[model samples]
Target: MAIHASPRVTEILAQKYVEPLRESGEFAHEIVESLRAYVDNQMNIPAAARSIPVHVNTLRYRLRRFEELTGCYLEDTSTVIEVSWVLEVFGRDL
Candidate 1:
């Protein structure tokens, strides 16, 4: 059976797991902005890079660095989903 999650539950999970990534000082504001945009766009890294006016490789490198700093892999489906939800719920606060 497929499991479905409520929006509130998703949001809560996001708050618990994702929001701290943005507040961390390990990445620059530009990198955080790029990551937020990418998560919002559903992991469209190339499009996010274009929006940020950075090279795709540069974006990838930044993302990798973020993962190293946070011990969270942005490319993982679960991590991406949580990060996306967090950005949607609290990105403006950051």
Candidate 2:
């Protein structure tokens, strides 16, 4: 699980996916945090929700909202990969 570690790549990915979430305001952090948990939990809704200490329904809503806002499907490999990298690189700052 090696990141490209390219600053430019991170910047671009952040701009495309992560930035929008940030621009979305305070709730955006919760969304990104939920997404990170979702990915960390291997996309298992229950597991992710538990990890976040949130209700499954809440997590589901956040995920759905994320997809709706970003137009990036979690079920897509490319989206997941790019997002995973962005999370690894810029997640803390976001």
Candidate 3:
């Protein structure tokens, strides 16, 4: 028999993965905004930093902190998947 992934299971996993970040404080909010902007802009770090009005180093630092808090690197495959889900689900709110 072949195991198949279900939509309900995927939805649940997506929600579980996104809940913490959604509930986090201002830092997470900023990080999410920054990340979304970066992803939306095709992963352009300098452009994102400029758009967010922060220095590149500051943006990088915040991104590092975000990775630490979320225990997921923004560049990682799984994290990218989760981030994409979050962006799709809540992009308008951010």
Q: In terms of lDDT, which candidate is strongest? A: 2
Which number leads on TM-score? 2
lDDT per residue, candidate 1, 1-94, as tens digits? 1114467776666555555555765555656687786876668988888887889999888788667756788768887766666556555444
- lDDT rank, highest first? 2, 1, 3
Compute the lDDT for candidate 2.
Answer: 0.86
Against the reference, the lDDT scores of all candidates come to: 0.68, 0.86, 0.68
Q: Write the per-residue lDDT of candidate 3 for residues 9-60, one digit (tens) a residue.
A: 4466456555556666666678777777677766778988998788888788
The TM-scores of all predictions, comma-separated, are: 0.63, 0.88, 0.69
After superposing candidate 1 on the true structure, give the runs of residues whose Cα lies further than 4 Å from its correct spot.
Answer: 1-27
Candidate 3 wrongly placed segments (more than 4 Å):
1-17, 22-24, 92-94
lDDT, candidate 2, at 5: 50
Comparing 1 and 2 by TM-score, which wins?
Answer: 2
The lDDT, on a scale of 0 to 1, for candidate 3 is: 0.68
